[model samples]
Target chain A: MKGFIDLHLRPNLEERVEIERIIKRAAELGYRAVGVSLPQEKLQERAREIRKICSDLDIDFISRIDLEPRNSLELLRSLRFLRRRVEVIAVKCLSKSVARQAAKDRRVDILSFSPIDLRRRFFDSAEAELASKTQVSLEFDMAPLLYLHGNQRINLLWKMRIETIIARKFDVPIVLSSGVSEAWLLRKPEDYASLGYLFGLDLENAKKAISENPKKIVERNRRKLSPNYVAPGIYVIRRGKDCPK
Target chain B: MPKIVRRRYIAVRIDSDQTIERKDFIRAVWSSILRLFGEYGASQTELKMIDYDPTKGLAVLRCSHKALPMIKASIPCITHIGASPVTIHVERVSGTLKALRRKLSI
Candidate 1:
């Protein structure tokens, strides 16, 4: 039942006060993790201030890459102070090229395919190839799914394809997130379980995607995720083992 | 596979060239059409029937037009004038709240 909320960090406009408010609220709400999106204009000092706030709270801090492809190295370099303070580096990959380039950086904790960018080009064949080459885990954001609901059948079809790719590929781990913006917009874990089941992720895998996997990401990156490493119990159901697909 | 309580249909003629396109088009229209047929189907407590084809440039859809407005509106454009079957399939899904209440009352 543990869930994470993306704080949608706005770098300017007195973010420390805003972030502290969210961190305290998140701690109260029993949220195990909080993700922050970096703005392109972020300076080294700004990253340090954010990192310090997260460290002080003993909350799991996840940094989502905010800069474009050309600025990725700079983004990585700027995030050095926050790296030891943050657990996961969430990158947006719009194309196979972007995904490949993002994959080159071992610092990236998760590679999420952007639906906005991948709408025209379905990730049917290319994504599988990329996953095979990278050995990096993939994540599907829920934002595009909502946006493309009535507009594109390809969007729905692509999600199905991506989930199928994750299952059959075996080498890559696929994580699912609602990519929530407003706290009230968070979907119940049961809701995701149904969608995952429909998309060929069995109950066990669905549970992992919802609960355990994020915890693992956070635990693995302890200094950034939190002051203490609290590894939760995980029940692994090997694909095609004990359950019929 | 479940016990079918209501039946309606959309019959479309399938031509070789545009079979897939016609099928996709009809299916895209099918969901909207069902909304128009909702009331009649609701009163009758029955399921729906759906069928369509592209080869003959015809679509036959069946559902209660009273309950669904969209279905009634979209049917005419794809309707076949000379086609013998003007039926639309209505499917009353099992375990619906209405069905559950009926069973509970009995």
Candidate 2:
């Protein structure tokens, strides 16, 4: 069975639902896993607590840290420190340099470029090539659509269409995140897929953004964090002396 | 002689705190389509609310086959109807309303 996972879901603040309640709702919504965004400070303590609750509910909960760095140096420092700690590392692109750097970094799992960001055109073919080469997925957050209306919404959609075209041209992985701050805002995976279609992704590619691409990032990072992992595509295993050579 | 227009029925399930009337629901969908795709695309859809159950929050909507993607694309764009917030989920789509109802057990 194909698993559906929402790669970005923030803790419900306005609704103030308990963490367990959020996990239960996500499960009911047919999500096999959900990535919960947490603050960078005290990440280890919070992740441990959330992981326990998710385990009891039989839902794969990924601890994600979202960073909005002011410069490339800050971004790299945060990435170096947090990569080993969290299951997913997402950097919000605030400048052209940061966007380009994040796209080329192997440690970065997701580069989030919102339509409301400062850059008129945040992503171009160059960044797309870097993203494709480094295996970093460009993220499109759906939260803006929840509030923006009329021409504002239309403009965001137009920008998204251009970004999608560039990403598709370079064959860069495109991932969709709801960026929901409230529990009710959490949408079903199929809805995200439909939204992807509006952004110019075909049905298959859109579905991949919601499922396969994110799953691959999680699995790859999980292996890299394992004790036996030496490097990418290399693992070390102890051989028993008693076994025939 | 005019050829028959191929139609598709989408089974939509509404998730909300309060029950929404069928009239209000159709109005919401039309306004959403208009907002997202503009007047020309809205006319092209030929959208209609075929059947709706307020209690269950399930509805089967009919649209031209070519406009199915446009309709699906617009479902998530509807954030609210009146003052009540709602989320629309497209459960299934089929060639006939009868087939959609049977598959969805509506």
Error of 1 at A175 (Å): 1.8
User: Please, what are the lDDT tens digits per residue for candidate 1 over residues B49-104?
Assistant: 34344444544445442323233323322222232212222122222444523433
Give DockQ for candidates 1 onward, in order.
Answer: 0.03, 0.70
For all predictions in the order shown, the interface RMSD in Å is: 16.1, 1.2
Residues A91-187 of candidate 1 have per-residue lDDT tens digits of: 6655546556555555566666556544523244455556546544566554344334343534454566665655456555666665644332333
Q: Per-residue error at A137 for model 1, in Å?
A: 1.9
Candidate 1 regions exceeding 4 Å error are A1-30, A40-59, A70-86, A119-135, A223-245, B1-106
Q: Which candidate is the best by lDDT?
A: 2
lDDT of 2: 0.84
Model 2 segments beyond 4 Å from truth? A12-18, A118-121, A239-245
The 0-to-1 C-alpha lDDT of every candidate, in the order given, reads 0.48, 0.84
Worst 10 residues of 2 chain A by lDDT: A11-20
